[model samples]
Structures are given as structure tokens and as C-alpha cells.
Target: MELLKVSGVNKAFGGLKALNDVNLTVNEGTVHAIIGPNGAGKSTLLNCFVGRLIPDTGTVMFADKSLIGLKAHQINQAGVSRVFQTPEIFGELSLLQNVMIPTMAKRDGEFALHAFKRLDKDAEIIDTALHSLEDVGLADKKDVIANSLSRGDKRRLELAMCLVQSPRLLLLDEPTAGMSRADTNNTIDLLKRIGEDHNITKVVIEHDMHVVFSLATTVSVLAQGTVICEGKPQDIKGDPRVQEAYLGGAHL
Candidate 1:
């Protein structure tokens, strides 16, 4: 079943067209990757899905409902969660605390630091957060300050935050933007494990082909804001259009 469907999507900035009648479909329980060169409107398309930017003309359907005008939080509440390029975590808070915020928000529709003092007394939410941290291999550091974590751990922390929400669709924007090869590979394995454990569908916007090929079940090539080609990883690797979209036929 298709979880996300974008049809005739168009967006523009003044006279510059960002996405031009683009269309895409992501099936359920698959890691779908959108790859493109810089300025190809990959981020723009993602914004449309999350309600940061509404498409000038098109329909974005998520699980049979229109996501075109929903607020960011509303979309999040609708089971769509996003991990940004930069790890978005509370630097001053502990790993457990960072995870608990979303857990509270998902249940109560809002969260506040004032309520954090009650975390120790709230076993249910704390257990949920601890399980999320454990899933991301951060349970041992639950008491550590968020800012003190390494980039890889910080990214894992961010994933724990998202996982706490029990999102049905996870959108990852450059999940491994800055990391060593070891960390990158670790993240790949972690994502794979998460998919196997949760069976959640994922949409990844990436520039690194290695990450794309390693994690993506399906690949879509975006060039100048248009989807030029899409297929399985091996098929995309051999597509000439994908090669041309990279750096002038320089082997995709």
C-alpha cells in the first residue's frame, strides 16, 4: 500500500520554480530515498510534506488524508516524524529528559519543562523514554547531558526522540550529515534494525550514495526539482539519467 503520494506538486519562489509538477509514491514499510544534487528542491519537497511550505499546486496525501495544509505539529501528530540534518536535541537536558519531552507531548498534545520535575514519579512515560533510548543504544548514557554526547550519539539521541513518538512514517533529512565512516556505518545498521523492529516506513533525503544504496529499498532521482528516474537501488545505479543528474555523467 502507498503510504505517501505526491502528485502534480509544484512550488515556486518568486519567478524561480523549485518543484515542477513532480510526483512520487512511497509504499508502506519501505525505506524510500530521494537523491539529488544541491538546489534540486529536495528540501523544498520535504517541507511540503511537513507543512513548512505548502505546494503552489498539487496534492500530498499521507495514509489517504491530505497533508497539504496541516500544521507541523498536526502532521507530527498524524504519525509523521522528521529528523533534521542537524541533531535537534535539548543540549541542557539529560538523554532521558530529552526523550521524555516528546513522549509527554504525544500523550498530552503539549510538553513543558515545568512538568519535567514529575518525570521520576511518572513511571509509564519514563519507561517509554528508557525503552526508546535502549533501542538507540543510548540507555547506558541516559543520565548524561545531551550536549556532551558525541555526534553519533547525539544523532542516536535524536532518533530516540523520534522513536518515542511511535511514528508511522519517519522522514530523515541527511541523517548522517557529519560523521566518521565508522559512525556512518553504525547509523546504517541502527536504521536497519529499527526498520526490522518497528516495521515503520522511511523517506530519506540524502546526498551520499553509499548511505542511499545501503538503506534505501527504493530510490528516486531528483534533478532541477523534477523526479527524473526512480527504481530499486541497483536499477538506479545503472540509470543514465541518474548518472547525468549527479555531475555530468560521472557514474552514479
Candidate 2:
């Protein structure tokens, strides 16, 4: 079953086209990756799906609903969530509190004012936030200030916050951007577990080949504002065109 369908999507700035006639499909409950060199339109394509940029043409459909015209928050409400390259968290807030804000917003639809209130009155919300933290193996650090955590833990905390929303489609941009080898492996393990345990569909935009090959069941390569190739990871790994256009070039 297809969970996301994007067809003939085009976006341009002045004279340069960032994305041109791009079409992509993500099946339900699978990890699909979009990869390419630095200048590729990978991030632009993601922005289109999440409503950060409105496409010049074509349509984006998620769970059978048209997503082209919706605002970013409306897109989230429509069951799509995104994690950026940079971790977005409240540095002064406790890790659990960070997760609680989104969880409550998803449930009660107000995050700003409610975040200041004591969470002790909402036992269910607190429990849900704890469970989300546990899913990313950060339950013990729940009370720690977000800024004090290591870089990897901050990434994990961000993931935990996103999970608390229970989004159907999770969009991740450079999820493992900076981390030690051990932390990278741990993140890979967590993503694998999440993919198995939940029915969530993931679309990741990353430059790390190791990360891409490890988690992506299917891969798509973009170059110069267009999709160059797409298939299983193994197929993409060996494709001569991919090697010449991306890997074999001086860049990698």
C-alpha cells in the first residue's frame, strides 16, 4: 500500500529549478531514503512534502489527502512530522518536558500556554512522554536539561519528541548528522527497532551512505534538480550512473 504519492512536482527559484518533474512513492510501513550530492534538490523535495515550500506544479498526497496547499502545522495535523538537520529543542527545558509539549499539543491542540502548567495533573500525558523517551532509550535522562545532554542524546531527544506526536509519516533530514561511531550505531539500532515495532512510514534525506544503506529498503538518487535513479540499495550501490554522477565524482 502506498502511504505517500508525489507526482510531477516542480519548484524553481528565479531561473534555476530546484526540483523538476519529480515523482516519488513511499509504501506503507517502510523506510525510504532520498540521497544525492550536495547540490541536489533532496532538501527542497522534502520541504515540498511538509509544506515549507509550495511547489510550482504537481501534487503531494499523504494517506490519500492532498497536501500541496496546507500549512506546515496543518500538514503535521494531517499526520506528517519532520525532524530537521539541526536538533530543535528547548535547551532550558527538561527532556521529558520537551516531549510533553508536543504530546499535549497533538492531543489538546495548544502547546504555548499549556507548556507552562504543571504536568502532574496530566498523568496520562506524562506517561506517554516517558514511554516516548524510553523508546529512544533516554528515559533516565528525562529530568536532565536538554542543553546538558551530549550531541547524540540531543538527537535522540529530538526523535523522542517527534515520536510523541505519533505521526504516520516521519520525515527526517540528516538524522545522524554528527555523532560518534558508537552513537551512530545506536541510532541505527533505534531506527530499525522503530521501523519494526510501529507502522510508521519514514522518508529520510541523508548524505551518509552507511546510514542510507543500513536503513533504506529503497533508495532514490537526485542530481541537478532531478531524480537520477532509484531502486534497492544494492542496485543503487552498483549502478554505474550513480557512481559517475555522485560517488565516482571528485565530491565523494
Candidate 3:
């Protein structure tokens, strides 16, 4: 059931160690969250997994393949996709077109420069893109310009774009970074539905305790570059170590 395995991971810059001996395993269909204080190296660890950073030492195995030396695109092709904290959709493009780019790349392996060439000519790719948008409840906004949509809709577009890739594992970095309470709750609901229906494992790095509690089946708390504690949400909520290190002694 383990789809991704990371062991003995370490990354450092100069004399400061960002991640030290970090070990994590993500099963095929579950939501795993990594929570920590501001400087606990959560983003650094995520970069290592998605090929944005090369660790000083570690082994990352995805679907039994070594992912150490692969480039970012190679990692994406190897069935892992990541969504950044900020929405990465192209503001100039329509919502549907933003999703179409990945769909075309997945199928044709290249970004054709001719806008005149209809990407929707491929029935399966178009169908998948539309379904992905529908999953995020943005199917009705397909023709809206990406920049014109609200912040929450932009996040939904980003999710739809990632979903079009059909990645086995999705890495989300604070999917609700700057949003209203209503928007944040909507995102949590979308993530829960995705976990249940898409069959994709998720590794989320979140600072919001509410979001973490709602979406994470398992939580790992990091402090000063190492894991301080890990367990189910209920146990983590009651753990003194987690509370002191990251939750500020509050039962979040």
C-alpha cells in the first residue's frame, strides 16, 4: 500500500540543517499532513520530494522507482504532481485553457505553439479536463478568464489543472494560504472529496490547524528540522509534545 517512501532524508544550507534524518511514507489512498512552526523545514522537505531540491542524503522511491536524480518534469511524468501555495494558473488564459495545457502535455509530450490547433480534438483528453474541472465545481466557469475569477475559484482552477495530470500523489503547499474562512472551508471540502473519489494520495504542508484536522488522517509534527511527533488527528490534538512544539499549548 506504500506508494511513496522517503528515508534518512537530510538537507542543509551552510551550517543550518533544514531537514535532518526525515522519514515519511505515503500510502496509496490517504491524506497525510506535515505540520510545523514557521522554520521547521516543511517547505524544504516538500521541495525535496518534488525534485525542486536535491537533498544532501536520502532515498525517495515512488512506485518502486528511484527519484533522486530525476528532473522536475521527469518526476511529474513519473506520476507525482505538486500545487504551490499561490495559484499557478495563467491569468491570460481561460479556466478551461489552463487545464488543457497539462492535458495536452500528458498526451503529446510537447506544448504546441499553434493556438489555432484545437487541443479538444482529442476526445479523451478533453473529457478528462472537463471532468477535472467538474470535480472542483468549476465546470461552469470554464470560459471565464483566470485572472477575473475570485481567489477561491483560482485555487480551484489550480486543483483542476493538477487533477488533469492524473498523478498518483499530489503535494499541496498550503492550499488555502490567503483566503476567507468560507473559502478555506470550501477548499477543505474539495480536498476531502478528492481524497475519496480520485484515489490519489495527498501530502499536504499546512499551517492552518483547522484545515489539517479536517483533511489529515495522519499528522506529523516537525520542529527544528526533525519530527517531534506523529499520529492520528485525535492523538495529535491531545499530545503535549505537538501542542508545545507547534500548537502553542492549545488543543488545536
Candidate 4:
């Protein structure tokens, strides 16, 4: 089944066409990779999905519901979670406390239960947060300050934060960005585990070909604001259109 449907999407900044009649469909429980060189409007398309940007002319449907005008929190509540290119976490909070934020999140985007206050009322949230930490391989660091962790650990924490929300759709922007090869491979293993454990559908926007080929079940190559080719991993690897999109050549 199609989990997401984006049709006739277009975005422009002044005369610059960021997205031009772009269309994409993501199947449920599949890791769909959106790849391109820089300035191909991948970010803009992701923003549109999460309500950060409203397309000039298009319909983005999640489970057949129109998502064009929903607020970010509302979209999040509707089971769409985004992991930004850079990890975003509370620097002063402990790892466990940070993971609890999404679980304790009120509808209006506030924490109804304070981290220190109402411990009894927060028991369920706290337990879930701890479990999420364990799943992300950060259980031992639960009490450590968020800012003290390495960059890779920070990324894992952010993923844990998103996972606790139980999102049906996870949007990842360069999830392994700036990581050493070991860390990158670790991330691939982590994602593989998550896919096995959850019924989540993923749309990953990544520049790393290794990461894309390793994790993606399907790939869409975009250039000049349009998707020029899309297919399975091996198919995309040999496609002339896909090659030209990334290697500085004319659009297909």
C-alpha cells in the first residue's frame, strides 16, 4: 500500500524553481531513498512533507489525508517524524530525560509532565524512554549529559527520540552525515534493526551512495527539480540517468 503520495508538487523562490511538478509515492514498510547532487530540491520536498514548506501547487497525502496545511506538531501527531541533518537535542538534559520529551509531549508542543515533577505520573513515559535508549545502544549513557556524547552517539540519541514517538513514517536527512566508515556501518545496522522491529516506512535523503545502496529498497534520482529515474538498488546503479544526475551531466 502507498503510505505517502506527493503529486504535482512545485516550489519556487522568486524565479528559482526549487521543485517542478515533482511526484513521488512511498510504499508502506519500505525504505525509499531520494538521491541527487546538492540543490536538487530534496530538502524542499522533505520540508513540504513535514509542513515546513507549502508547495505552490500540489497535494501531499498520507493515508489519503491531505497534509498541505497541517501544523508541524499536528503532522508529527499524525505519525510523521523527521530527523534533521544535524541532531537536535537538549544540551543540558540527560540522555534518558531527552528521550522522554517526545513521549511526554503535549498536543500543543509542551511537556505536560516536567522531568523532575510528577514522577509518579511520568512512570510510563520514563520506562518507555529508557527502553528506547537501550534500543539505540545508549542505555549505559542514560544519565550522561546530552552534550557530552560523541557526534555519532548524539545521532543515535536523536533517532531514539524519534522512535519513542512510534511514527509510521520517518524522514531522515543525511542520517549518517559526517560519520567515519565504522560509524556509518553501525548506523546501517541500526536502521536494519529498526526496520525489522517496527512497521515504519522511511524516506531517506542522503548524499552517501554507500548508505543509499546499503539501506534503500527503492531509489529515486532527482535533478533540475524533477525525478529522472527510480528503481531498485541494482537497477539505479547502472542507469544512465541516475549516473548523470550525480556526476555533473545533462538531465535525462
Index of the highest-TM-score prediction: 1
What ranking of all candidate models by lDDT puts the best one first?
Answer: 1, 4, 2, 3
- Candidate 2 per-residue lDDT over residues 1-252, each given as its tens digit: 999999999999999999989999999888999999887899999999988899999999898999988988888888888888988888999998999888987997633565576777889999999999999999998899999998888888998888889899999999888777777788889989987887689999988899999999999999878888999999999998898877565643
lDDT for 154 in candidate 1 is 89
What TM-score, over all chains together, does every model reach? 0.95, 0.94, 0.92, 0.94
Q: Measured by TM-score, how close is model 2 to the native structure?
A: 0.94
User: Could you tell me how far off, in angstroms, the CA of residue 135 lies in candidate 2 after the best superposition?
Assistant: 1.3
Segments of candidate 3 deviating more than 4 angstroms: 110-117, 247-252
What lDDT does model 3 reach?
Answer: 0.88
Model 1 C-alpha lDDT per residue in residues 54-75, reported as the tens digit of each score: 9999999999999988999999
lDDT (CA) per prediction: 0.93, 0.89, 0.88, 0.91
Worst 10 residues of 3 by lDDT: 243-252
Please write out the lDDT profile of model 4 over residues 93-208, one tens digit for every residue.
99998998787772225334444667546678888989999999999999999999999999999999999888999999999999999999999999999989987899999999
What TM value does model 3 have?
0.92
Candidate 1 accuracy as TM-score: 0.95
Residue 160, candidate 4: Cα error in Å is 0.2
Candidate 2 achieves a global lDDT of 0.89
